[model samples]
Every structure is written in structure tokens, then in C-alpha cells.
Target: MKITVMTADEQFITLDVDPEESVENVKALLEVETRVSLQQQQLLFNGKEMRNAERLSSVGVRDNDLVMMVLHTSAPSSRAPTNDLSFHPDGSAINPGAFQQHVRRDSDMMAQLLQRDPALAQAILGSDLNGLQNLLRERHQQRLELRRQQEEEMALMYADPFDVESQKKIEAAIRQKGIDENWAAALEYNPEAFARVIMLYVDMEVNGVPLKAFVDSGAQSTIISKSCAERCGLLRLLDQRYKGIAHGVGQTEILGRIHVAPIKIGNIFYPCSFMVLDAPNMEFLFGLDMLRKHQCIIDLKENVLRVGGGEVSVPFLQEKDIPTHFLDESRYSKQGSLGPGSLPESSGAKEKNDNMPTGSRSSGTTLSDPTRGPEFEAKIAKLVDLGFGREAVIQALSLFNGNEEQAAGFLFGG
Candidate 1:
């Protein structure tokens, strides 16, 4: 079979040989044909370094196929080469263009060599073949040494910790880890410790009455204050059968639930159901149920609440625009302890105990009703001093007929 061999200098050598011929035999033939020594010739077929024992047919070589030849630096031959392009006689300058094309053919190797040894660029440009070859050899050896050191380090990493050599590395690694952890901890700041974030609220209208709706995904059911419901004309729609206690960070009396109400958000009215709680501070809460039913997405990235699967986006109220009452942490801090009295009475909504029997009164009513004896006043003061809200203490006392133990139990959710 006839095959062509392309030299690094782009010279072609056509040879007729057997398909079963070994790669070493082919190199010997190339040496005789090109006058280059066999030891200096490196054979590559299809970009793979061919083994000496690999046959032409076994290496996937066929008729008319091309193999590449790379010549490396070696001792001078006894007989001077006549037509070899890589070698020059008596310090003759190599062809700069041919040398550049040869190096550029393997872009990765050329880049690595240039990065490791910047002077390689000058050598290539100067057409100094011997100098370029020496620089490449030095860089290659340095790379091999670096690889050997890395392999040794990796081996040591898994070696016995009790070994004398490994002890220093282990100690150094532990010290480095501690230093890194300390640095990270020093740079980390907890926002809750130094600052408070404003609650998320959006402008919404319920039954023609405008109100701020607190967007709380953490709330399982949507809720609205009884006063807000009455203001929005939704009080008439409340189903008293759903009357129960609403439990969260604190427990509150749920008067009833509004079965259905239209809440207008950004010109779009969405049907929303609300559990009517006697809460005084927050007028409305947009909870998870409505969020999921409406396909709402709380996009913190854009700082907006996306409704109807992103069809509409409503921006939350800014800090300056948000009501100061909602931003007061101290009011909420005494939540469960204060009971109904914990709620502000600025609005005209009746106290939570308004529905209770005439004989019982909430703390708010007890405080104003001078007819109550001094003994009742002392009991209320005692419970209030114990961190229980005055209204809650009075209600508890009423439920237990003024028995402090039972009332304390009731106050603690017993």
C-alpha cells in the first residue's frame, strides 16, 4: 500500500510499504528517505503517538492515508543530511514563517510555552530554532517537576497522620481553617440584631373601602380585623358558624369568616375569603391560601407581589409610606400577655368581651368602671405585674372566678 508522510516542515514523503509493516520499520524507511536519524523521528498517525510495535493496519492506517512526522533535537549525525528542512548547515538561520506555522499548529502547547516562558515569543520571532527548542525543553521539564511535586503532595494528604512529616501539614491546615472561619464570622452581620425590616404592605380596596393589605406568605389563612370588615361593608357577609380561636405567634378570638369578598388590587378585583379576627393593629393580612389560589408570586428580586401568574405586579409600600403603627415592634412584643387590651382602642370597635355576660368585663372596662371594689383592683394589678396583659388577666380571672392559679393556667394556654 502507498501512504504519504507529512513532515513538521510540511514536506511530503511518499512510501510504498506492506499493510502489516510495523511503525518502527516505517520510521527506518523515513530516516533513509529524508536523511534524518531514526531516533529523532517521532511518528504520529491521526494525532496519536504510534507505538513501535503497532502495525500500519492495526493502527487504522490505510492506502493514501497521511501520517505526521515530528523531529526532535538530537546529536549530530555522522553523515550530514542533504534535504532535511529542520536542520541548517553552519549556523544558518531557520525559516521564521515555517517555524511559526509549526509551533502554531499545536495552539495549546504554544500558548502554555509562551505563558511559562515569555522569552519563547522572542526566540520564535528571531527565527532561532535551537534557542526555541532549548526553551521548550526547559519549560517541559519544569512542568514535569511541578506535576511530580503535586502528586507527592496529594500522596501525603492521605498518609498516616501520625507520621512526622504529615504532622506539620495537618497543624497548618487546622490553623488555616480556624483563621478562615474567624474571618468569615467577623465579616458576617445579623440584620435582626442591628436593624428591623418594614412589613410588606400593598394598597388594596375591599368592598370600595381602601386599606393596606399585609402580604404574609407565612400566614396559612387570610385574615382581616372586625373593624376593617365593618368599614368595607363585609361584616354582613360574615358566617358566624366559623367562629373559633385563631392561633399563631399569639391566639385571638375569630368572630367569624367572610365567605367571599372582592379585593381590588391594581384595577383587578380578585375574589378573596377572610377570617374575621378582632385584631386592632393590622387591618388586613394577605395569607398563603389567597396567594396560592390566585397564583401569586412574592418576587423579592423585583420587590413586588406578582399576581395571576405574573400578569400583574404591585409594588409594596415604601418604609416612609407604611403606617407607623405597623412598624412599632413594642406593641406586638406584648402580644399574648395583653389580650384584648394589647390592641389599641383608638377605633370605635367594641372590646372582645362585649359579647360576654354582663357580670364579666374586660380589663379596659374594669379600669374605667369605678364601681368595682379595691380588692378587684389589687388582683388586676398583681396579674399585670406578672407580665400578663391587664385585659387578659381580668378575662382569665373572670373565667376562673378570680382564682389566680387557674387564671394563670388559662393565660399560659392551659
Candidate 2:
């Protein structure tokens, strides 16, 4: 297990050691890397001193946990050593010697940099300190040069537009400024479009098996996958008379409907029904029908699902805790067929072309490739008149499937 040991000087030393190892062994390892004697080392975890004989696990130390190390001097000194080094909060060392020492001890950071830049690794590993010092100086100068260039560009943006000498620069600056304003307006009006949507989910049990039910109020009926129903032994209660194809944004075949089952949410069990779908990707969906029937409240402010008219409250899963596979929309789209309201295929559609790419959707009347037709050229010209670049307008239109409003919104940073 890897654990971080932070010194009193705020320097972090990550150590990969076993949880069952004695605390004394950890101090001994720190002594070799930190140049501090084991006798001068005092390890503290969670504000409590750790005993030398005690194992790290017995004292509540886990993987990636932090342990504080304080150093003590055997004798008082009038002056500090020139070699003594400290670290800044951003992880930069005060001196090249400190950085070299840290890089040698941190295997994870070394392995990452080794993969990224071999020249950087060579400089750090070199015996001569001048190479490392020169490398750091070059990096510092590069950052300063970038900052100077940005400042000069900003000055040109604010320069007089009517002046003859700076006409070209002023025109370019004005175009960029218009794009910036459009982006800012879109962000202010619709911030939700830029936010990461955390789907609401509540913990519940079907019969005796635990399950996480997604709360989607837009759905007409509570639905469960056929595999989930079979796992819960509820397939016997399925009524095949209600089986049909559901049409909406997409279409899915409904296998059947379960009449009723006891669903345990929190401490109470409520009678709930489910429409079984043949989908294997999704486990369960808590739709509007069951939510309204149970008088459930989806409290956005508190971020909890209130079941049984506020009688039981269940917290929604956080972004980090949500299942990775559930976030993939492409998997669901592959299983669905075209709905009734879908647009017709383009007139240029090729019949049974073996050269066609797999999983590619049929393009409509508006051409995705600008070279395909004059209609796309006309549309691009109309959008470019609104002060956006010709290339940007073409890309936005293609991305949005030729929807003018949605394309404009995307170009404005939505």
C-alpha cells in the first residue's frame, strides 16, 4: 500500500509499504530517503503519535493515508546549513538539490516523466548539478515569454480601431472580441448546458436483492431490464398481454409487465410495479408513474429522493461513485431503433454499399461534408455573415446536424 508521509517542513514523501508493517520500519525507510535519523523521527497520524512497535493497520492507518513526520536536532546550531531545502505549496523545490533528491525517491512521478520526456529524465539523473539548474532556468524564461506575448496581444485588442496604422490588428481584435461576447452571453443565459449532469439514483431492494434505481421523471412507466427481473425472481409475475413496442426519442421492445412487487426503500416496503424491457445494458429505471403513486419528492436543493411522502429519504449517488458503464449513452443508442418522428434519409443515400463505414448514421439533406453540395455552401455563407469564421460555422453546423439554433448556440459556447 502507498502512504504519504508529510514532514514538518511541508515536504511530502510517498512510501509504498505494507499495512501490517511495524511503525519503526517505516521510520527506518524514511531515514534512508530523508537523511534524518530514526531517533530524530516522530511519526503522527490523525493527530495521534504512533508507537514504534505497533503495526500501521492496528493504529488505523490505511492506504493513501497521511502520516506526519517531525524532525529533531540532537544539538542546537547557531546557523542553518546552506544545503537545507524546503518546498513550496505548488511542489517546486527551493533548490536543485532538493528537487533531484525528491525525484529519485518518487518512483511514480519519475515513471510518468520518463514516459513523457526522456530529455527531462536525463537531466535529473545527471551527476552534474549545472545541467539541472540550466533546465530550470530555461523553463522559467519560457513562462515569462508566454506571459509577455499575451500582454502585448491584450494591448492590441484595446487599441484604437479607427487609427490607420493599427487597422488590420484592430479588425482582427474586434472579431475575437465579438466571439468572446457571444460566448459570455450564452454561458450567462444557459449555465446548465456547460455543467456535468449528475443523474439522480436511489438505493432500493427488489424482493431481497439490492439494486440502484435511476430516477428519471421523464419516463412514462417504471421499467426494469429482463435480466434484473429474472435475478429478483419476479419473472413469474410478468403479464405478457401488456407487451409492446414503446416509441419516444428512441424505440425499445417491452417484454412484459410485472403486476406488483414489494420494493424496500430505506426502512419501509412499498408496492411497486415494473415494465420489463429486453435491454441488458440498463438495470432499472424509476419512472414518473411510480414516483407520482408513492408521492415521492425529488429535492434538488437537498439532493435527496424523498419516498412515501417525505417519510423516508435516500441520498443520490455522487459523480465519483456512479457506475462507469451507466454514463455511456452510445450503448443505449445502439440497442434502440429509429422512432416515428425521425427524419428521412438523404436523397444521395447509397443502397447496400459495402464500402460504407460501420456504425455511421445516414446523413440528411444538409450535407456534413461542405464539398458535397451548394446548399451547405449557402448555409455556411449565411452563418459567416454573423461575424463568425467560415471554418467554425461549417464545423458547428455539421456537429449539430444542420439545426440553425443549436449550431449557433454551440458556436456561442453552449
Candidate 3:
């Protein structure tokens, strides 16, 4: 992207930038030129928070695009940088343009590096921002760029373009998906892929106890279940405002103690990250942290999520077939992660009470009877083979309203 950086004083510094550079990077550039602390800057990319990890090209920033940067004060000194652009600590001049250009070159070179080493660039570029700024100031521009590029490219042989062409491919696919044109057009379209399944790893060590969990992609965030948090002594993180929690379908409850982890998924992880909400009743909802890096191929029928140019599969979804008899239509209508407004049909979901009779003794704990048929049995066999503990499969199937075909497609890839 070619961005014209109008400093707080209105001095414009136009520079061509890598489309994949983040808005945070743009802010860094402004800080460099304006001698403004990052905390003192307000950036609006279309009047919203300048997107992080959202590539400039995807956001419609062209070679001569003008970006606005303002300096904000009144924030505590702890927040704002010390009125300085020189991060060298030893006092040095930062060439923002050269620094950024070098970063762009490194990203370009990363395309050619070894596949197993892709995270290398992100580690260096995203981490130690202050250190990198110092290095850029001290080193010869060309030498720095040359060394990193060689280091990056020597590791690989191909790079994917993150540009309009890529987005056109997305738009074309949306058009072909048979979606309503108006709805599709109405979406200003998130730059790059907007929807994401988060990828994260847990890091918790308190009282000599290390409790870890891999961030589930389908899960919204790093969930420290209320039960788990209490037992683990991590409850201090949540201030008991009791804002409530959201779970699969629309179920909500006042809960506490959960944190989010920044992770890499699809392809890359982000920087200066945040934590996920802590809620006792909710199962968790993964957000942008996981989704941003991936170009996903969601095969509803196949129940597969393909990421990053289809080089590999994350995990296959276990499908369950729903049966017709016990299928309650309303159960499947539930949506969200909060409240009974849409709790998924699970945990022995009860059917319409009135349907049973004036006085009936319920058999209890039954979602469906197994005598339905061999075809149904076969679907159950598939789910069983998929390893959805029989109990879970039964619950998910009941919720899917006995659409065994849909459930199987949903739980286990067709």
C-alpha cells in the first residue's frame, strides 16, 4: 500500500508499503515521523479501529492513499511512550520508511523460505518491536534489508499474493455459492477473511501447577471453565461484575475466570494480543485471533475445514445423523453462545411437555430409541466410529432434529 502519513502536525510522508503490513505498523510509522508515542495516537481506518493483521491491500489502501493519524494526550504516563521516537535507549534516529521497507522485503522473502520455518519471520517482525526499531536506526539500510531477505528467501521458493486478485477470488466464490445478491453486496466485505476459527495454546502456571490446554478451533476462546478455574486457583483474573457468559446456541449465565490466548491458525499469529472472555456456563467462542491467518474452505457436506492453500487438513469433523421421530424442530433453531434464547439441544433436552399426556411417567434420560432401523443404525455406526462418545453423538443428533444426514454431515464429515 502507498500510504501518505499526515503526522499530527499535518506533515505528509508518503511511502509505498507492503499490503500485508498491519495497521499497527502504520501507527508505528506515524510514531516514528511524529515523535509520538503509540499510546498517544488515534488511528481510524474508515472511522473504525485500524485493523490489526488486516493487510493494507485488502483494505483498499492504494499507493497514494492518505491515512489519518492523531495524537491523544491525557492518558496516564504509564501508557504513553516517553515523548520519543528513538527506541535505541542509547539515542538514535529511526528511519521509519527504511525500517518498513526492510520489513516488507523480509515478508516478501519469507515466501521462498522453507515451509517448516514460516513462523521465523513473524517471530522477528512481530516480536521485540522496540529492538527492531533500534536495529533499523543503527544498521545500514541496504545491508539490513539484504541480510534479512537472503535469510528469508533462502528458506523457501514461493509466495502467495495478498491483494485484490485474492479478494476477487473470494467474491467470485460468494457469487457462485448461490447466496442472495443483495445480502452479498450489502456486506462491505471484510478485508481478507473476516470469519475465523481461533487457534491457541494455554500457558498457566500458578502455585507450582501448570494446567495447559490446546485452544480448540471451533471453540470461541480459551475457556477456563468455571469449575476448572476454581480448582486451578486462577479465579483472580475475573472481576466479579458478573457480566454473564455465552455458550453454544443462546445460553447465558453469570460466570467468571477465563482468558484468551493469541495463536497462529490457518497460517500466522498476531501480536500485542488479548484474552478471551471468562464465563462459567459458556463452552467458549473462538474469534479473529484464529481466523485471520486462514483462507478457509468449509465443506458443509464433507464436514471439512481446509486452511492455507489446501496443503493440509486441521481435523475432520465427526458427523452424526439425526433421526426423524424424536426430532423437535424448535431445538435446532437455537443460536449463539449465551442464554436459553438458543441453548443447543443437549444434556438430555426435554421435548414439549404437553405432547406426552395429562399424566405420564417419563422414561428419563432418553433422546431416542435405538429400534429405528438399520439405516439409522448405520449412521450411528459412522458417528460411533468417528468417536463422538455415544452420549455426545446422541445429544447432538437430537438437537439437529434427527436430520441424520445433516447431523452426520455436521458431526462427522459426510
Lowest-lDDT window of 10 residues in candidate 3?
339-348
Full-model lDDT for every candidate: 0.66, 0.67, 0.44
Q: Which stretches of candidate 1 lie above 4 Å from their native place?
A: 1-193, 337-414
* TM-score of candidate 1 against the unseen true structure: 0.38
The candidate maximizing lDDT is: 2
Residues 22-84, candidate 1: write the lDDT tens digits.
887787666535546666788998899898788999999999999999986864553323333
Q: How displaced is residue 194 in candidate 1, in Å? A: 3.9
TM-score of each: 0.38, 0.42, 0.22
RMSD of each: 23.6, 19.0, 25.4
Best by TM-score: 2
lDDT of 3 by residue, 206-227 (tens): 2234433333333322334455
Please list all clashing residue pairs in model 1, or write none if there are none. 337-389
lDDT (tens digit, per residue) of candidate 2 on 125-163:
888777766665664465446556555676777768788
Worst 10 residues of 2 by lDDT: 340-349
